[model samples]
Target chain A: MSLGCELSDLQLDALRELMNIGFGQAAAALSEVIDLRVILTVPKILVLKPEEVPAFIDAEVEMPSSFSMVEQFFFGHFEGTSFLLLPEEEGRKLASLFGAEAAPLPPELETGSLERETVVEIGNIIIGACVGKIAEILKDQVAFQAPRFIEAPVDRSSLERRLAGAKDLALVFKTVFHFERQDVFGFLFLVASEGSLEWMRAAVDEYLGSLA
Target chain B: MGFKVLIVDDSMVARLAIKGIVKDSVDSLAEASSGEAALDLLAGGREPDLVFLDLTMPGMGGIEALKAIRSGHPSVKVAVVTADIQARTLAEVRACGAYEVIRKPADRAAVLALVSRARGEGAAP
Candidate 1:
């Protein structure tokens, strides 16, 4: 069964604009936390069946071998799943940037409290911004769970495993985030089941009409 | 007059970073690891002029704490100090009645400015 509804051209345009706003908000949060310029490429939104995700991941870019924090949040009429990928090389720089008192050892286990804090905060900010933009566009209120940071290296296979468990039919959207100073790169994902997608479209339409 | 501030975050390192910024302008502050402990401090009669809250936490996250704090002490002003910049999240925080929303890893100057703004200062930087 399909997990998400496909987006119409107009809905796609609307969602694209809204996603940009959300990304900008996430960038602002990153700037504050990283104490550096945080830039985000224009978000790339795609409506694809769940099966298409593996192809997209394998073809677009090689998944970086680094520790990442995967966060999940749900809001009024929509749900968002976000992944923050930090390059392992940047891990040392991040330790210094956040003034972590730890040996510049390997990131697999050498991370200290401060770096963990930084990671969690960064994850929260981006997720918050993206979700906030969506809510604003939909003109609805939704509660969010604080970001949960997992200190684990993400490989292509692992990501594929996660994607495989997604709802039957799905709407997959992706965005790229580029952090200055340490060359930290990350991506945000939005997955909606088919039923959820229909509800989301109607919710977004209502929001647009209210705005008009 | 300068006011006391309390910061609640799991990372002692984060607490220190925020302390560095807050100390530049504010004279008093305290730190807590979780929302429940922060509330415990307040219940123990420790009152602060401001609270810098981290949204994502292990237990009793920022949202829950915000509701608890507001209902218990409507007078305390809260500035959500987090790195999450999602608009939907901010709208919810605002709806929760936060005094202001400030992003995490804030600089010394920004910290002073945000607190001042929340306290109804001239304007935010």
Candidate 2:
């Protein structure tokens, strides 16, 4: 069943607020790191079948020929993968903000390229801050895997294959990031595993109850 | 009699959370979803003794709102409620004339204490 079917309006609202606070903290963290004002859109929560994510991303980003993606896994009461996606041009702009040079590298050395390193660092800071704050608010503990940078064209099939490990449903939390200085924009997608759905609902209720 | 309080934030949940904490302690409560809305409430003559404002919002954010309230309604105390607890942010709000800054996911006792303090202070003269 869909999250909308399972969660009431108030519950959804609570979830949205939680994400807002989480992303607010993330923005602050990124701001301090980059010394730029980071503006984040309110996070949109959607329950989509795993296969639908690629189409959603394609529609959102207009399916650039190639994009930079950083994939990281978080585990806890809320467990899932988080992806930070930026178009190649935007990624280059972000890398330049970090003073990364655009020297050409051979395929073998591309894995350790400075641009890839810069993007991964940005992804780690954003994901860690957002997930950490959410967990802190829920009073849950989480651990994260190393972020992996993917520099390749992300087609529907490729993305679907990557999501093959996800269960029947994925709870996707999407937000856009705007870095004021460079006017760089990126998309952050947190795909919660099916296992976390029940816990998520319960946690939100518990939080609301505490407030009451 | 108790003091009137205004809870301002873009998130309905946040406003409700603060409201739940201080509703019984205060005489009256008002809610605003944005800084501009909060300013409008004050401009329209809703004179709350204390205003709990959130910093980040769509338009006329907490800082600008705080400055306007300080200039227009000097007696109205404002407490910034935000998740952005950076030193710079806190210092900026204080410099802008916020009486206090309450971190988001606010603690109930802290909120109560702030309300109690506001009541005592507002009650004076």
Candidate 3:
């Protein structure tokens, strides 16, 4: 079923600005964490049916091989699950940058343990900053669950499974963060649950009203 | 006479927000979505006393645009308004001749203060 909520051009523009601000904060936090220059693309916002989200991601993300992903759920008036996807090679490069000094891994760790831990830590920072900024600007509060590391190839069915409880529709905020000097980048997506539509619209309107 | 202003940002909402903040204070206000477009406007004979620019745009990002503005229109003051608040980025923009750097989710008072400065008036109360 559709969410039956259609946002106006102005509303969508407002949401896009919100995402830009959110991801901009995320990039800043990430730069501090990794000590690399972080640049982000112009963030995009779209309202889509829950089932269509996977295809949209596949088209936008363009991962050639297996990818590393971190999923974290945020709860509050503006609730959603945020996904951070990095190509396997790039993820490895990023993990390597952490080295023993930044995030010392146990000598007995498994093959991909360092990569997993690195992505989870990075995901926590990116998702926290993005969602936290958006929530704060919209005058709402949010809390996040621990991030889950996913090492599988991303497929339609698997992605759909990530949206299991998100009935009706979802608003996807997508952006790519480029790690300058390191040549590593990742796609960040925030899938707002259908339940957030009404509240989101009201919050956005209120935000615009303040600007007016 | 009120000073002319230009707002450069890819996001329409951001343009609107800044415009709303400085609209009453400025004599004329113009907006462009990218660095290239902002230059085009200036070349097209739209000169503003102050330009509010965003750093992370699609093409010809803010730093390049700032340098070009400094070269061609040395009198026009450019303020970098963006979410990329890294120390390096801030230092680079300042070195490139940005009149000021305003963080995104643009704060109203800060924006007004910049406009006031641009108008040769003191900080906004």
TM-score, second chain, candidate 3: 0.94
The candidate scoring highest on lDDT is: 3
Rank order (by lDDT, best first)? 3, 2, 1
The reply for model 3, stretches above 4 Å from the true place, is A1-5, A61-65, A100-105, B123-125
Local distance difference test, per candidate? 0.66, 0.79, 0.82
Runs of candidate 2 with Cα error greater than 4 angstroms are A62-65, A100-112, B121-125
DockQ values of all predictions: 0.04, 0.46, 0.75
Q: Which of 1 and 3 is ahead in DockQ?
A: 3
Candidate 1's residue-wise lDDT over A1-212, tens digit each?
Answer: 33334555656655765666576677766666556655444456776665676566556656455455556666566754555555444444565666633346566654566567667776677677777767765766667777776666766666667767665544445665555555555556666644556678898666445433
| lDDT at position B87, candidate 2 | 63
How do the residues A1-212 of candidate 3 rate in per-residue lDDT, one tens digit apiece? 44535788888888888778877777777777778878777876787777887777678756554568899999999888888877777678888776633745568986488778888998898889888888899999999999999975755677778777677566777676667666676667677876876898899999988887
Every candidate's fraction of true contacts kept comes to: 0.06, 0.37, 0.69
Q: In lDDT terms, how accurate is model 1?
A: 0.66
Q: Is the docking of candidate 1 incorrect, acceptable, medium or high quality?
A: incorrect
Best by TM-score: 3
TM-score comparison, 1 vs 3, better candidate: 3
Assess every candidate by TM-score: 0.53, 0.86, 0.92
Clashes per model (N, Cα, C within 3 A): 23, 0, 0
Clashing pairs in 3: none
